[model samples]
Target chain A: MPLAKRIIPCLDIKNGTTVKGINFVELRDAGDPVELAAAYSKQGADELTFLDITATHEGRKTFVQLVERIAAHINIPFTVGGGIHELRDVERLLVAGADKISINSAALRHPELITEIADHFGSQVCVVAIDAREDDNDWHCYLNGGRIPTAHKLFDWAHEAQERGAGEILFTSMNHDGVKQGYALSALRHLHEQLNIPIIASGGAGTKNHFVEAFEQGMADAALAASVFHFGEIPIPELKSYLCEQGIPIRKL
Target chain B: MNIVILKYNAGNIRSVDHALRRLGVEATITDDHDLIRQADKVIFPGVGEAKYTIEYLRNHGLDKLLLELTNPVLGICLGMQLMCSHSEEGDADLLGIFDQKVKKFQSPSTDFKIPHMGWNTLTDTKSPLFEGISDNEFTYFVHSYYVPVCEHTIATTDYIHPFSAALHKDNYYATQFHPEKSAGVGERILKNFLAL
Candidate 1:
């Protein structure tokens, strides 16, 4: 059988707690990171991505501890992102139990960082997260939590990222983020056509059909969202069953 | 059980350790031949370039030691590839524990990706390693190269072509998929390995 499409639950963490700002689940509303991670694993999430939206040097250590705690409970792949500035940071997170490391702003600043991590740890361990926003018929890449725009185009940077040895691309549309309308299917389709590596679509996932559209229209390998899964608006088991009924190849519970 | 996870500079070592911990086994991750040899069960898990890994093993004399391990040993991913006689990756020779050749996947068309990432089901799972794993249950896999089916293949997965998903020879067993990351099915497979 062919590989099944993946459903990933993203957690926007701040100061070692799941930040429920964008969605109705207030701060710490979805429970602790380790507890929520275990719940998601039991619900049959393909993987989990924990993004430390804001972190100081001390807060980074706390995040590592959180990763260690989560690792002890769950038995699935999880990626750690945000504030990953150096090779040492990646090393620390991996050693602390993160299966993969996701990088954005640092990668934009020093493209060689991608190659370096790939050379040292293989491409499978490094994920290049591209936050893109539409501007004048062109999707432009952004950095620093989608606040600063870059001169590099989305497709160009994605191509460059793969060339530099990124195993996958996690593309988030800033315009669609928190909007709960739908994914940027056109952008995702364009990327799927251009890149050979796996593409994970992120943002604007409100309903179960939004995920199906990601796979059907966007041709995404995985669909990731935070609020929908965190707030219990859509439980993972029900989502998987829905996707399976929709003829998408999902891991049966 | 005194489980020892042989460590090199491979990625996801912690993942394996964490998996065993979830199973209530505090597996030791060590390269010390003595520690590895003394363990009740040894797990050779790794994900890295074969050439560099082979070089490290040879330099540390682990290549010779692994060839002579008597206890039950389980290899994973690149660890499984390294146990083969030869690998096309980096043109590096391996431990010859399985007496097979590892070759990179050649796509018949452009529709297939090279690495073959994500979850896929396993077939012909006959080894004790998959004692409780249901047939065709999905397991996580991520690799560009694969070992063709042979007498040693205990499980097979079809992608571009049928390849060995799990291999067994006497006391040595290995899987190309990451049981540590395959969720429930994966944990069951790991538990089966421990029971063995």
Candidate 2:
């Protein structure tokens, strides 16, 4: 049976190492991407997502070496994002052994690229990574690590993405990023209500209960976080047990 | 010897590549047909709907290519389903290499969800695939459709009905569960598959 719910672990890689902090600050090295990914795979993570937060800033694709290393070690489905803007980026990521390529800025600037990726790679292999912010008025979408704002409404962009044949949506709320407050439930719900494919809810993970709430309140198919899992604040297996005790559907190791 | 994983427009190739490496069996991932054909063993895995996947193969004309392979092939989850005769999901047509039909598990009878996610036990173990593995051992699963029990039923698991958990025919074998994501037992299964 297909997984009804997913618990994903995110590793923000900068300078070939995993880093995590609020608003992308106090950047601390977690560990090697391959080592951390292998550990997570052993712990029964349903899937893994890698954000190359420094790839663009570094002006090169850092994923080829890291992704190849991880793929040579960790055996599970994983995604790669950050600095992905063209077919070459997708090609390089795929060549490095990424199961899926996620587009955010590129998807917004040239929506046709979404179709091109979908048409070439199939919708399942192309996931649109959307970073959003709630400005006390209406939800607005952001790209390039929340630097560029898209004029398209959050729900509107999600709908366009689905129409363009995106297999999944990796949504991170800028307002919630690193806050560990919780996922932006309203925006998540808005995207969920609009799209049929799976939605991986990222950012704002403070506690184990946040994962539960991401499912119960946000109705997200998956909940993703970096610090909680990296710091051992919430061991995934124990969290799964608690979720099981709560009757939440989770993939057992 | 290194096992080559054909990385086309499919799903979950990296995990398989990583699993082999963890088992100390060097694995290479590539879409080049020659490398796949030359591999000691081949694995075709997928996570999307079978029809579109089949269409993708048909579009690329790789369906016939996959069916022609003679090496020990292990298909996982969607990869396993695509090797079957047909699929109920999306009314998809499969490669039909295995004499079985992949049918969607309809909970029209009880409260069991359509896509059975999580761990379940495997029984009726027949093939060497479970050589080091135990009976009634649970593995990870994530799918809405499943292959029904047939002559190829090397193992069985009950969701609402006893369904085929694993299948075997000649050198081609498959599992509805993901060995890559199944922890150490999964690694052992991959090792077992490699040994064949």
Candidate 3:
């Protein structure tokens, strides 16, 4: 059997608590990050991702403490993002038991950081997340939590990241995010064709069928969603069962 | 039982420590030769490039110390690769406990990624390390290089092809997958190792 398609639940954390909001606004408290991580692991999530939305200096300290707690409680591997500025931050998170570290703006600003991370740690430890939106029939990469648009094209930047030794690419379509529609299939498929590393499809995962589409059509190695898994709209076990029935290779508990 | 995780310059060693803690066993992370030698079980866990790590091991004399230990020793991911005869990653020669050569995954096509990240099933299980685990049970794997099936292979997992997922030779056991991060199945595997 081929490698099972991964189902990852993303926790947008702020001040040590998990939060979910529509389009990154009107935030609502979900629960404690550690408790949610433990529950998701029990539900057989292939991996858990905690993105520190605030990324404040104080929040970074608390986030590190939170990572330690999640590592102590959860047995599955996890990736942590947000406010990872340098090698020291990556080292700290890994030391706190994070299996992988994702970087976005910092990586875009300093492409050398990707090579540094992959060289110091390993390519498997570096995950480059790209937030891009389709503009004039071409996707343009965004930065600073999708507020500032960059001149880097989606495909070109993703390719560069892969060349720079990124293990995986987490591509989130800003247009599809928070819409509950579906992933950016064309872009994801394009990435799958252009890059050799695993591509994680993020944004616009409404139903379980959307996930199936992401895998079958988008060719995504993993599908990441924040609200659908957090709001109890779709339980991970049921989703996995549905994906399995769809002839998708999934890890069934 | 005293569990010492042979710690050199490597990533994700703490995650192994945390996993053992979840199993109610606190493993000490150290490079101390005496502590590792005295432990009932030694876990050689790592996630880094083999070339530099193997060099560090040799410089610290861990390469020879590891060979001398008679206790049950478990190697994870890069630790497993370093136990092989040689690695294609850096063309570096490693400890010859398994006699298998590690080779980088040549993606036959884009369908198979290099890292082989995500969960996959384990088959041909023969070791007590998988005592409570059944065949075709899923485990987490994240690595670019793999040891092909060999005489020492106790378990096999298929990605691009059948490769050595777990190896067993006397007191030394190694797994290409991260059993520490494989959820309940991994926890059971660790418990089985402790029972050994």
Candidate 4:
């Protein structure tokens, strides 16, 4: 069988607990990170991602502890993001048993960090996540959780990141994030065309068909979402069955 | 049983330790040659560049120590690649346990992604390592280079084409996939390895 399209359930974690909200606001408690992670793994989630929504020094320490706990319990591959500033931070997270670390703002500010990470810990350990919003017809990259915009356009930055040795591109459409209509297929398709590494489509995953479109149309290697899976809007087993029925290759439980 | 995870300058060693802990086995992570030789089983697990890792092994005398071990040994991902005779990555020579060469995956077309970075199935499996595992069972993989199917191949997985998913010769065993991160099927594979 060919490689199955990955279905990753993302958890936005604050302090030490999982939280879900819209556009990174209106936060609400979901559940414990370790328990939720084990549940998702049992439900046949291809992979799991945890974004440390907490932004303080204490919170960062707490997040590391949480990562260790999740790693001790969950058996599937997982990526941890949020507040990854330097090579030391990446090293800390990986040492804590994270399979991969996602860097967004820090990567944009210092592109050399990508090369440093890849060179030091192999390319597979570095995941460059880009949070961008579509403006008119172009997509502009954002900083500080989409509050600040940068001069780096979507395609240009993504191309540059691939050149700098990013193992994968996590492209999250800020406009589609939290809205849950669908993914930005055209942009994702463009990324798939321009880059050689795997592209993970994030945001705007409201329904199972949205996932289908992301993989089939967007040409994404994986589709990631939060609220839908967190709130039980779409159970993973049923979703995998649906994708299988739709003729899409998926890992059955 | 005493198990030691041979450690070197590589990533994901802690992950291997964590996976074993979940299975109720507390493995000692070390590079000590005496400890590795004394253990009932040794896991040579790594996720890093083959060039530097092989160099590290040679410098620390692990390259020779590993070859002399008579007990069962399991290598994962980069560890498996280093067990081959040669690797195109960094143009390095490695331990020739498998009598094969590791080649980087060239995308035949745009549809096939490099790194093969997701779940894939194993076919033609024929080893005690896959005792309880069925044919075409899925395992997690994340690597750009692969060992082509050969006489020593115990299991095969097709990405660009058929390649060695698992290899066995004598007491030396290796897998290109990360069983530590492959969930249930992976756990079964590890249990089989321990039993061996």
**Which numbered prediction scores highest in DockQ against the true structure?**
3
Model 3: which docking level applies? Answer: high
Q: Write one digit per residue (lDDT tens) for candidate 3, span A90-206.
A: 989988889899999999999999999998888998999999999889999999989999999999999999999999999999999999999999999999988899999999999
- Could you tell me the fnat of model 3? 0.89
Selected candidate, larger DockQ, 2 vs 4:
4
Instruction: List model 2 lDDT by residue over A99-192, tens digit each.
Output: 6778899899989988888777667678898888877767788877789887777788888898888878889888888888888887777666
- TM-score per candidate: 0.95, 0.78, 0.97, 0.97
The residue-by-residue lDDT of candidate 1 on A187-236, one tens digit each, is 99998888878899999999999999999999999999988887788888
Candidates 1 and 3, the one with greater lDDT? 3
Encode model 4's per-residue lDDT on A1-253: one tens digit a residue: 6899999999888988877642322223336778777778898999999999997899999999999998889999999999999999999999998999999999999999999999998889889999999999989999998999999999999999999999999999999998989999999999999888999999899999999999999999999988888788888898999999988988886
TM-score of chain A of 2: 0.91
Deviation from native of the Cα of residue A186 in model 2, angstroms: 3.8
* Model 1 residue A39 lDDT score: 73
Which lDDT tens digits does candidate 4 get at residues B113-171? 88789999989999989998888789999999999999999999999899999999999
lDDT of 3 by residue, B1-196 (tens): 8999988998778888888888889888889999999999999988888899999999999999999999999999999999989999889999989888899989988999889998999999998899978889999999889999999999999998999999999999999999889999998998888889
Please report, as a residue range, the 10-residue window in candidate 1 chain A with the lowest summed lDDT.
A21-30
Per-candidate local distance difference test = 0.89, 0.77, 0.91, 0.92
Interface RMSD of each: 1.5, 5.6, 0.8, 0.9
Q: Between the candidate structures 1 and 4, which one is better when assessed by DockQ?
A: 4
Query: Can you rank all candidates by lDDT, best first?
Result: 4, 3, 1, 2
Better of 3 and 4 by lDDT: 4
